[model samples]
Target: MLNTGQNLRPGSQLFSSVSESNHAKGKYYLGNQQDGNLVIYPAGTIDADSSYWSTGTSNRGLLLTLSLDPNGTLWMFDGNTSFTKTLFLTNQSSGAAPAVENYYCLTLDADGVLRLYSHVFLRLEGKPTIKVAWQVPGDRCLVKGVCGPNSFCQLTMTGETSCSCLPGFEFLSTNQSTLGCWRTLPISGCVRSNNSSNEETRMMATMVEVKNTTWPENPYDALPVTTSIEDCKLLCLSDCACQISMFSDSYCSKQMVPIRYGRISGSNNTLFVKVYTYRAIQRKKIAGAGAMLISGATLVVLSLVVLSGSVFLICRHKRSLRYMRAPQLYDCKVDGDIGLQSYSFQDLDVATNGFTQELGRGAYGTVFKGVLANISKEIAVKRLEKMAEEGEREFHREVRAIARTHHRNLLHLLGFCKESMCHLLGYDYMPNGSLANILFNSDVRPSWSKRVAIALDVARGLHYLHEEIQNPIIHCDIKPENILIDRSGIAKIADFGLAKLLIGNQTNTLTGIRGTRGYLAPEWSKNTAITVKVDVYSYGIMLLEIISCKRSMELKRAGSEYNISEWAYECVMFGETKKVADDACIEEAELVRMLKVGIWCTQNMPVMRPAMKSVVMMMEGSKEVRQPPRPASFSQS
Candidate 1:
């Protein structure tokens, strides 16, 4: 008996002979076959071609049942309610529920489709029309056996499915191409015949290459590895039983005749079809010998033109190479901030050798050490790993901000790459490492004068970014990790991944909290507008670390002394400034002066913080260092 408009709960079984019809008396109905495939077939028929939709879950398990839950999701599961494993599911389509309580069913209509429908009971004295809620294998071509063996299926521009015969095969029926295809010539076994040897048979056959196509059939033999596509093709041609072969990523698979489930693909798979050498030659002969003669002349003319152009380009490139070989010209190109180089992702990937040497990781990506063989210059490549749209904007902004500025203290942007989904920035490599290593981890810290000079270097870089440029920029993240030391021990500011640019004459902008904690300005947490002063606060904390060689907020340091700025201020109050200086050859006067400048910069109020320009002067002793009030709310203790 067929039932309609009834919900199938968990453990409800539909046998091979059982079916549920649509409430509107449709000719088609839903049934679960004895082979364990849930299918939709028309009335009084079970032919394979007549059934266009199936769950494809044959041999799932014993005692399987199809259930449609209250949320409108239909699922097929094996076993009983207590121990069930879900095999397949379809998501709910419509948000509206059936007006009749607990009313829904899997229905098959005259259109030859299996669907889940909801009957909305009308308030008036009238019957309710059923709405199609969901259907599987929506396109007819997705149904298996639609296009039989030796043929491929594809969708036309009009969105209709079509079938085509594979190479070296002919359509079984022109009127109904879906009936599939047959090979034009039969192939013999691998056993050597009296007339031909195995090698001779291979020479008589040729492999035709087909790109962007695949057949999902399992291979009879698979080679673990092959050197190239040519090697895979040769192996397939050498085998008498192999009619089709697929090669991808060094792996080759050999398939027998009558390849099934053929379709055009966008993957990297390449299909090779074996055919007789005569047939292959016959196809090529369609172009004719006259066309080949013309093509030969055209190729000779084109080759000469290409050779002449290549000679001119080679000479021109050598001249440019000679000009750029000088250190001064190469440095000038980076320092002038004009005509920046645009590198391709492939070039950078080859330079970095697949980004094997990782230097460090940042918020968005990792930095790698690479050398450009063409220019013979070592560089650090920052490859952004975030492939989202937002990450692309940040990449472009960083490139734009650094490309427009030139300063000795600021890291130079040598080039950039924005290809496909890859984003990378190239800069001159710093062999001396970062300031964080020198301050906190190094065994031998630099002398007092050298440390002061390093502080001045960073201050000058920040000053140039905050005021010296036409459009003022804010280095939102300023910490020891960002300050890199060059071969000359000159500190250069790097990692502008978080830097923000202020529009024409705009000194401040509102933004969410950014920058490392313990270095962040008080205004950041208050949800107020941020300015260059935030960077000053961060630099102040880093400056104290530079002077004392202690982290700003060391959790390991006990007794209210973890915060370096707070502890330094207390030491200064007691006139024991020497206690704050960690270097054995500390210059007491310079330490006091630098510490005072640092204190002023870390003031709780952004208004009280000195600008980066003033900090540079104080570090160089051009401006007098005065007594700074206790850095109020800035304490990290």
Candidate 2:
């Protein structure tokens, strides 16, 4: 069942076996049931136990298909139906679904889990970069009976699990504890019976208390009547079968042999275990007490000597530390819009599999697919080609600003990794990837409606960055490659590497030709103050590409060389507006209106460019947009 893009059509199913990472061993299927609920179950399932997971997508006569987008989005959609779904394997993959489903996978691990993995499959380049987008039992604790009975399991934030034995008990083995713990001290010879005539057989026992520890368990035996700590201790001590006694808020839980235990990281409960004292155990050998005392003193003196020598040697040894990057690092909330998950270089290494799979390449660096193990979250890790301290400072500033942004249209900064000469950034993976992929590479062309929708989504996000935030952000490079789409068909602003943040009320200017060649604003070429209008101009170019599905680099007509903006204007006026657009079903009025806005955004004068806010309203048909004069372009004539 190595399905690349299997369409689980409405009323059909996608099945997988209970073993292996491939569906060949699968007994499970993600089905669109009659009740509108898409469920994962074994074949011939009629009950709840047959299901592993489900999507509640039910309609009387709705049609939908389960697909994985190019950027690793697992989606269920019909574009024409209410049954459309936008599901993410990881929040990083929270962008527009593919225009048409592409390469991705559904893996059924032998560990009894169903997961969705997506790969950016480039047939020509022959690079298949796979990423785990979504998975089941994401939490290690959620696994059934992961720790053996009678042992408490502790789950770390790094996705590692540890098992521990209770006091007076030891694990059956160091590696596995599925069989539970074995008792260290037996109570049969410790507690005395009144009917037993032999007084020498009686032994005194001591209770060892473990503090701030709790195990979550379905108590097979409990004593609600034990209103005090002493009562709970007495109840357990009276019964030799009780291995551990837990007391919390006057409630007592006694676990017998083969206990089911799990450790809560921040618990306040206490577990007390009764064990026979050394004096009690040696009662039968009282005649040799003097000799035993002498031996014990000698052992104590030897132990102190060893402890002192170990500390002296440890102090002389130098230490080197390397952090093991984990998912917990990326879970920090810096501000409202940003969550900075700081990861170790090693974490990124593991996530990207040594950076073997690359999603895309840019002037700054390359981005690869990564998965956070602890939370089972998929993210895109951008590894910079250069890690200068100055660049690192700039990255930090950008992250701070991006984190404060909280809009659906903007790509969020999930986390970052910094170490000696290595700098990486983590972002929610966008399945649709960049707009360039849609307009240039893929055959799954976006319809006129989808193009318009994407234009509006990008507008809204840019509007937030330019107008809503405290400090206006000037995106020096705003192009199709910088615009990312989520599974929901909404677009978002991404790639802040060249983003410039305005400080206070002062208008600060920058130098140098910054953006991609074709989309760079004229102002960038001129020695003048850069403004948010630069982004406005680039966006206009991108908007046109969305409509025409062509690069806006250069266009010529009537044997005269001119820019795309000027060429588009001439075509629209001659009643050839349809010819100016890519082949798609679109109403004449909408096409004309969209074209007019694109023209207005590309106006030669910076003052003529409408703000992103205005762009959004015009695209959404919420504001009246007037027709503009032909946009002037840089002609070589």
Candidate 3:
């Protein structure tokens, strides 16, 4: 009968069929279940057969069958070598009627290639029965290599491996371990020989080869380059005692003193020169002729003087009048109700042991350590270098200025020695040497508190000089080496050679460039006018060095782009304030506070920087800190 919506088939092999009838829905009936093709009415229905069947449940709706290989094995559905079933399959299949199964499951391999197998057949055995074989893609290959010294290599299987040098190199630091090697050494430019044979022979050939590798160890003794190499050689050879000459492309440098560390690298470029034979002979001839002329002239002048005594006396009187009317080289004034006492040259000579003991040597003169036997005390004897005009003026200025000044921080002058051309000033002895020695030595590092104390001491000394002293003294050159520390670690400012007294209300002095290179104030470079602010700038640099445990010049290398001050400035700007503290300092808060004061003193603009008086207060934690302006040129290089 044909129903509204129904279609069915009887038997597993299509033995009965049903179609829709005009009045009733189609129905399906089966005579018996057998192993044959079968269909059910409606799209969703159940079918059964003697050997195989399928349920219409939503979960397991679709099922399939498989035939075994022709190896005397009965036909059975393949279920093994398929899905990896553990407890569920083992327990459920064992209790229930033998589970109807079909084709095996497939899985992805390590290379992501799919593999199919027979689950029922493979599970009956101990191990998997199927095997998979496929080629691995070329992109999946691995790479291995080694990096060479000063060269870094990275492995990349997708492309070629790469090798490169570290920063600050024109090429790879070392030759490649594999292919593509390159040289790292910079190509030597043109090798132009020095024009003067004497200079080349003395500096390049003789002195540099003979002396120790390192030269000019003392920072104070560094020579400045002047004229050409030939001129340099002539200058050195002209002076019989000249020891070394430093030559550059433009000028030749000659040192009439000791070469501290003699080593020179190609990068140094400067030449070291020594005296040659020909120049020595010339100098001797010149000195002989000059001496003979002086002797003959003195004898003739004495004979003329004896013949005309009255006439000579009248001429001498007139000469004296003329000399008295001439302007003095320097003006002098005394303070503190103390009268100036001048001793003869003979008196100082005996007191200083004939100037046998040299306490220190400077650009101006030698300071001899002396003991006044008559006075029963030790004193520093400063013998000024000979001067025709300017030097004498400076000597007199130094004597008058330092003589009247009396402060705990200032070095004390006892007396003075004056003669026709010789001058000497006496001072109290400082047992411990300058601050430079203690700060740079590797053997010991001063405690954090001690460094801060030294800074405060220096500031106080400057404050007194700028404010309390009758004639305000400006310490034009204020470096660590100029600061002397006594046995008790109390710092006293010394070396008043470059000091000048303030005239009237003048805040600045017009003078030639003086003081160390790294410590000079920026204003000094542009204008001749100098103020106490120059010393303040130098003190700032010194304070930064003390806190960071580094030298300003040493920080200019392949690394350390930022100098001690710049580095501290960066830390402050980035809000990483703790980085300013030195590793040796145990007190974090104190170190930061000191660094803040240092930055304030080092501000580029003179108007922005605080005076020594304000700096002292800030160090004592009595003042608040404002943001310091950026430095003009912070580069150490």
Which has the greatest lDDT? 1
Model 1 spans with C-alpha error above 4 angstroms: 1-337, 385-398, 501-511, 555-561, 582-584, 635-637
Any idea what lDDT model 2 has?
A: 0.66
Model 3 residue 512 lDDT? 57
lDDT of 1 at 106: 61
Residue 63 in candidate 2, Cα distance off native in Å: 57
Per-residue lDDT, model 3, residue 308, is 96
Q: Of 1 and 3, which scores higher on lDDT?
A: 1
Per-residue lDDT for 128-216 in model 3, tens only?
44432211112221111122222234436654445443222223323434221222321111122233433332122123322222232
Could you give candidate 1's per-residue lDDT for residues 125-180 as a string of tens digits? 36777776666667645544557678887878886668888788888878879767
What's model 2's TM-score? 0.46
Measured with C-alpha atoms, the lDDT of residue 475 in candidate 1 is: 76
Worst lDDT window (10 residues) for model 3? Answer: 42-51
lDDT of 3: 0.51
lDDT of 1 at 246: 88
